[model samples]
Target chain A: MITHSNVWRFFTKPLMKTRLAPRRGLNGLAGKDIGDRQSRIIFTVLGFTALTALLLIVLFLFLEGTALFIHPAEDGSRVGLGDFILGSFWYPGYTPPEFGILPLMAASLSVTVLSACLSIPLGMGTALYLSSVAGPRVREWGKPVIELLAAMPSVVLGLVGMMVIAPFMQEWWDVPSGLNMLNASVMLALMAIPTIASIADDALESVPRDLLEASYALGATPLQTLMRTRLPCALSGVGAGIILGLTRAMGETMVVLMCAGGAAQLSFSPLDAVRPMTSTIAAEMGETAVGSSHYSALFAIGITLFLMTFAFNLLASFIAGRYSQKGYQAA
Target chain B: MVNDPNAVEVKTLNFFYGEKQALKNINLDIKRNEITALIGPSGCGKSTFLRLLNRMNDLIAGVRLEGKILLNGMDIYAPEAESADIRRRVGMVFQKPNPFPKSIFNNVAYGPMLHGIKNKHGLNRIVESSLRAAALWEEVKDDLHKSALSLSGGQQQRLCLARALAMEPEVLLMDEPTSALDPISTSKIEELVMDLKNSYTVIIVTHNMQQAARISDKTCFFYMGELIESGATDQIFTLPQQRQTENYITGRFG
Candidate 1:
């Protein structure tokens, strides 16, 4: 008893109803059309493809990284996780290779801290300038240039650090080598400044005009309004920007590899050459034999770097959520 | 002219924004300790005239002014007159309630702090008294530390009123301060404004004819940037002399 006209009515009846109510009809068709359904299915598949790829990559990383603690090395000795992480010495090519990652972890932390010290103040200052101090014409030209800095390749920055900054430092301070922790930190700070400035500028600019007007109407000077009202309101967003910048500085590979001088020493001095975790993995992974203890150790270092960045990301989101909710409501 | 001790005297006042004039030549005297209501249709320059009283129009770019606005016999438009001092002495409450993102205490203390009253005890005293003056002290006394944004709309508007009062202004300029509120809140604000005239000169711009008639002692009707009529509120509402004022008041034309 099912006919072609019945099928036609099923589709055209809703279409006719929608056509009668211009806006609702269009929306209904958008939600129910065959072409739209097909596109949605395609997009879902594409999304799942990315998710599956990420999961597979993470699974591979864990399997290869944990193998170092389970598999016997060429010398028929299994390295324990505690010794691998806590060992102060790391000589992968020695007769009895020592793989203590504590020195690398220290170097990474130091450089990230140093870079943050340099970048945070500079980035926040830039953000404040771009958001409030600059006029419309100045902001129109200036914002894109700041964002363009974020797009600059890290390798180009590494080359500049190695070629320009290293020689300048060597001649100025009479250091043994220009490539040191200070040089690496300086380069990383340059890389982080753009990200911090752009995001923080957006935050400061988004502070309500009503607040500004209220402040002005209150007899407060412009500087007073900015310092007391605007800055406090945008604190969480600015904090998130700084944390993200620090994470980027900590995980940077090319800048540290080229500018850090690659010396694995647990020294507190800024001028001392250092080998951070990221550079070690990037520099050693190519030469280390696949499935060897050295290869697994490199993967283990990757896991550590992943976890560090993950923790920082969590902290950034926490700052953004908690303070933003408590700070302002557009009543 | 004999100097009035506590009155704002406007003489041939004209205002322009870029190429367009927003207010035509006008002359009026706003008395001290009296509620003056400015009633007009939208874009009739009532708000512009109110803002000019406190020099709030100066914040907009490319705006020009002519003639003299005298506050207590001193020309407020003189170059030596600082806008900041004027604003503090002539505080404003905008149409929409705009509380700072800070706590209720901080919100009320903001103006005093800007003027450098950093003492904890002094700030607490000012906050409490200002809230009481705004009729909001009892409701918010328990939650002084809570964020100002958490307050209800009516409470927030009262908080804004308290904030303006904290500066201890001589004149209060309100631009439709209760237009965005519900009826209850509007009545509360109306009562508060009526109470405020005993301590401060109040100039308010309102589109609501009933509100203007109820609380104001003096009423000015503006049409097309021109002051159509000015008189005691009762006479203006009951027996408007000008045809335009009478027509508009009787719901004939805007």
Candidate 2:
């Protein structure tokens, strides 16, 4: 009859029905419950798959590495785990096949330490400039360029270290060869700068504007405010970024392989050519017998690299957590 | 042109952000040793006006100002005048309590330390005096080494006040200092502001008309980008000369 109540009900009845029923899309194929369940299942599966993959890799490394200590080499010579790790020489292809990894470990540590010393200051300065000092126009262009630097292939960086940087460093320092600890460290620092700068910038950007205003109100110069307030507030984040960069420097393989001069010696000078653990593995893995002590020794070095990077990441996360807690309390 | 020496005097002031004008031509003289309150709705340029005295607006980009703000008969906006010097003479408290993420003692002593007061005993005395001035010494004396963020919101606001007072500024500017506080904290701050006028010239901006009336000797009402009315607090509240001021004070509209 088209009465007022009839028209009202007719208009609102479908809406009420739609509201009361399980939510549906335009196609009306799957209800909200079904969609939620499907998403939940998919997410759970994806998460477990990632976890399983990580666990499997760790398990494989542990199995393959421990085999070196359990069995003798192809030439029937055995080395204790302690001696293999702590002893300095690493003459693997020799008749007796000495598998000591101390030289490799030393080379890796020296490169990492040098790179960290160089990159931390430079990266943090870049981060501070990008976050606080730079104008909006500069930040808009500078940030993406730094990120693009991070996206550059590690292998390409290795090539540059081998070709461009090594020769220049050799000529500048008047060393015998360009491929040395200094050259590798410089390349690694370049590789690590973007990571440190970006993360530190994020931390600096997160500091509330009100605090800065308070500093200004208290008559602090911009430099004083940055030194006392901004830097202290972002210290934890900066520390985390440094740790992440150090971790990258420690675990990086291709650059060391290409430029760290494959001499497995324990020289302390930066100018000396040395072979890091990753380089030893990459240089010798193809020639060694499939099930030999050399193969297991390489896997052992891999485990050590994994453990080192894992420890640094843990430290980085701990610092990150402390900073976020400080943020929460301040909020 | 009043006979009394003005602590701060603004003449024909206009402020802009990019091309949009935030404050229109304004003229006011804040007397020495008195609390002058500016009250207005949000986005009414009251806070903007408050920040002009110490040149805090210099921190913001695209902010342009015309005319003069004078402190102690000196043009604060003069080409040779340094913002840091002006800010040291005039301190500010923000709407929200923003204590640095540091110990309460350090927060109060930050200004003194910045000004090269490095002696331990000197810093201690300044910290104690500043905390006492803000009326937070008794409550926080024992835990002065604790993080300033550990304090209650009201206590934190007072700490922020103490931080400003540590500079021993001649003029104190507060922008809605009690708006973020509870009723009791609000009243406490109101009382503190009243007491502060004896030693430091105080200028406050508040959205609460009652707060302005309770604490201020002179009340200024701002609407949009203009100063609508200003007079003795009692006269403005009781017999506002402007319709907008009456409507705002009467709760008819903001």
Candidate with best lDDT: 1
TM-score of chain B of each: 0.98, 0.97
Candidate 1 ranges with C-alpha deviation above 4 Å: A1-33, A328-331, B1-5
Q: What is the C-alpha lDDT of each candidate?
A: 0.90, 0.89
TM-score of each: 0.92, 0.92
Candidate 1: the clashing residue pairs are A18-A25, A87-A100
DockQ for all candidate structures vs. native: 0.52, 0.49
Worst 10 residues of 2 chain B by lDDT: B1-10
* Candidate 2 error regions (>4 Å): A1-35, A326-331, B1-4
Residues B1-254, candidate 1: write the lDDT tens digits.
Answer: 34464578899999999989999998998889999999988999999999898888887879999999998787889999988888888888999999998899999999999999999999999999999999999999999988898899999999999999999998899999999999999999999999998999999999899999999999999999999899999999999999999999999987
For model 2, give the TM-score of chain B.
0.97
Model 1: fraction of native contacts: 0.62
Task: Report how far off residue A214 is in candidate 2 (Å).
Answer: 0.5
DockQ of 1: 0.52
